[model samples]
Target chain A: AQSVAQPEDQVNVAEGNPLTVKCTYSVSGNPYLFWYVQYPNRGLQFLLKYITGDNLVKGSYGFEAEFNKSQTSFHLKKPSALVSDSALYFCAVGAFGNEKLTFGTGTRLTIIP
Target chain B: NAGVTQTPKFRILKIGQSMTLQCTQDMNHNYMYWYRQDPGMGLKLIYYSVGAGITDKGEVPNGYNVSRSTTEDFPLRLELAAPSQTSVYFCASSYSLGGSGNTIYFGEGSWLTVV
Candidate 1:
């Protein structure tokens, strides 16, 4: 079974400061991790994904995440936060061959100016 | 591309009434999915179809049913509208990795309320 855990329910960061949203996962084989962002009343938008290769992946909206295999973690990061960055972030994990993806609860990020 | 498109943007149903949320994709994806979003709970998969006529249950599939008659269409039906069924529903489509692409595309979503 594939499972993802986002320990933090909410994250707040000052504008222009770096922000990080933690995510961890457990899966059978090589994990396919993903990050998504949802604005108010909108569907989730894909942020980035780590299927194979580099541990660090860059995504849209100046967002990036690092995949730490030994720690079983994939944490989202932004060099600088903007007010428009405030939204709900989700972490998901899927296996190499499996089509099903297991998502974490979520983390609400607030960029305080 | 239009990616994934869903209909019935907002709807209110009476108890015991039934409704179907329609979804379509133009990306020629083989996999389609239905999911419901709840506050603080993220998104829960209601049902999914690997291809036409191959629907299967997902994490939360109790009160809903789905059908995929064509490669582009996947619809979800709610048998009995209950207050618990009120939620924001999303439809998504994707392809298997190593093909054209691996990213899953999602629709704007449909908001349903049962009164």
Candidate 2:
């Protein structure tokens, strides 16, 4: 079974400081990884995805993630955190051709202003 | 563009009551999915449809039913609503299967509370 684990339940960072949310996955084949952000009372919004090629993938709102094959991790990062960037982040994994996605428990990001 | 739309933004249902959550997409997406989000927990797939007339169960499909009658409509039905069914339901669609170039668009979500 393909699954994703987000180690932290919450991450606190100061505004303008760099932030990282760790994610790890276990899958049988090549993994299709994705990052999604959800604001209060709203559905998730797609941030970025890693399917093949580049290990470092850039996403919306100045977000990026590095896919490490050796460690089975795809951690989301932002050079500078903003108060508006605080939200719930989810890490998901799916098989190369599968349509189903397995998501992590989610990490609540809080940007302290 | 009204990417994906779900009807009845909020509803309160009594135990044993039944209702349907309607979803539609105008993007001509071939794949549609229904998911429910509980407090703190991430979204769990209730059901999914590959295309019109084809549907399958997902991780948490025990209390829900889904139907895909047209390419643009996928409605989820909750039979004998239980307190455990209280959660926000989301409808999503995708043009391609999972992976690159297959980004899923989500609806605003239908918040349901079963007492």
Candidate 3:
């Protein structure tokens, strides 16, 4: 079975400051990790994914996430935050041959301007 | 481009009533899924289909049913409406290449309220 955990339910970051949203996962084999953002009354939009090759992967909207194998963690990061960055963030994990992807409870990110 | 589309953007149902949420994908994905989202609960898989004629239950599939008649269409059915079933439903589809190359695409979502 594969699962993902996001410890923080909410995160607040000041505008123009760096931000991070933590995520961790458990899987039998190598994992495919992903980050998604959802705005009010909208569907989730894919941010980035870490499949293999690189421990650090950059994604859309200047967002990036680091995959730590030993720690079993993948944390989303941004160099600087903006007011428009406020939204609900979700972390998901899936292994090769697994059709279903397990998602975390979600973290609500609020950028204070 | 209309990657994934879902019908009945919003719906209201009374107890005992039933409804079907329609989903279609233009990408011709072989895998389709239905998920329900509740406040603070993230997304719970209701049902999924690997391809036409093949369906399986997911984490939360008790009150719902699904069918995949074609590669592009997968519809979810609610047997009996209940307050517990009220939620925002999402339809998604994906095709795998290998080495975890699958990236699922989601529909706009349908909001259902059981009164």
Candidate 4:
């Protein structure tokens, strides 16, 4: 079964500092990974995804992710963290050709002012 | 496009009472999914439809039912509401991934509480 694991239950970072949310995955074949952010009482918003080629994938709100095939990891990163960037983050993995997505437990990111 | 839209932003139901959560999308997406988000937990798939008239069970389908009567409408029904059923429900849609997979668009969500 395809699954994703987010090691951190929560990540705390100061405003303007770089932020990283670690995600690892296990799948039978090449994985299609995605990161989603959920604000309080709202639905998840897509942050970024790793499909193929280009190890570095850029996404919304200055967020980016690096697909490390050697490590089977796709970690979300931002050059500078904003207080507004604090939210619940989820990592999901789907098979290269399958539509079914398996998601991680989620990590709460807190950006301190 | 309006993407996916969910009705009844919030609802509180008594035990045994049943209600349906309505979802619609204008994206002409071929795939639609229903998911429930619980506190501190990742979203759980309740049911999904590949297209109009084709529906299937997902990870958590018990105590819930879904129908896709039109290509644009997919409504989820909760039978005999229970406190355990209280959670925020989300509707999402995506194009047929074919072999590459596609990004899904989600609605704001519908909050339901069974007391």
Which candidate number has the best lDDT?
Answer: 2
- Badly placed stretches (over 4 Å) of model 4 are B98-100
| Chain A TM per candidate, in order of listing | 0.98, 0.98, 0.99, 0.97
Share of the reference A-B contacts seen in candidate 1: 0.32
Give the least accurate 10-residue stretch of model 3 chain A, judged by summed lDDT.
A94-103
Where does candidate 1 chain A have its weakest 10-residue lDDT segment?
Answer: A94-103
**What is the Cα-based TM-score of model 2?**
0.97
Superposed model 2: Cα runs more than 4 Å off: B99-101
For candidate 3, lDDT tens digit of each residue in A1-113? Answer: 78899999999999999999999999998999999899988888889999999899999999999999999999999999999999999999998878788889999999999
Score residue A87 of candidate 2 by CA lDDT: 97
Better of 3 and 4 by TM-score: 3
Q: DockQ of all candidates, in order?
A: 0.45, 0.61, 0.53, 0.56
Which clashing pairs does model 1 show? none
For candidate 1, report its TM-score.
Answer: 0.96
Q: Write the per-residue lDDT of candidate 2 for residues B20-81, one digit (tens) a residue.
A: 99999999999999999987788899999999999999989998999898999999999999
Off by over 4 Å in 1: B97-101
Top-down DockQ ranking: 2, 4, 3, 1
Model 3 chain A TM-score equals 0.99
Give the proportion of true interface contacts each model preserves, from 0 to 1: 0.32, 0.55, 0.38, 0.43
lDDT of 4 by residue, B26-56 (tens): 9898999998998777888889899889999
Candidate 2 lDDT over A1-113, as tens digits, reads 88899999999999999999999999988898999999988888999999899999999999999999999999999999999999999999988668788889999999999
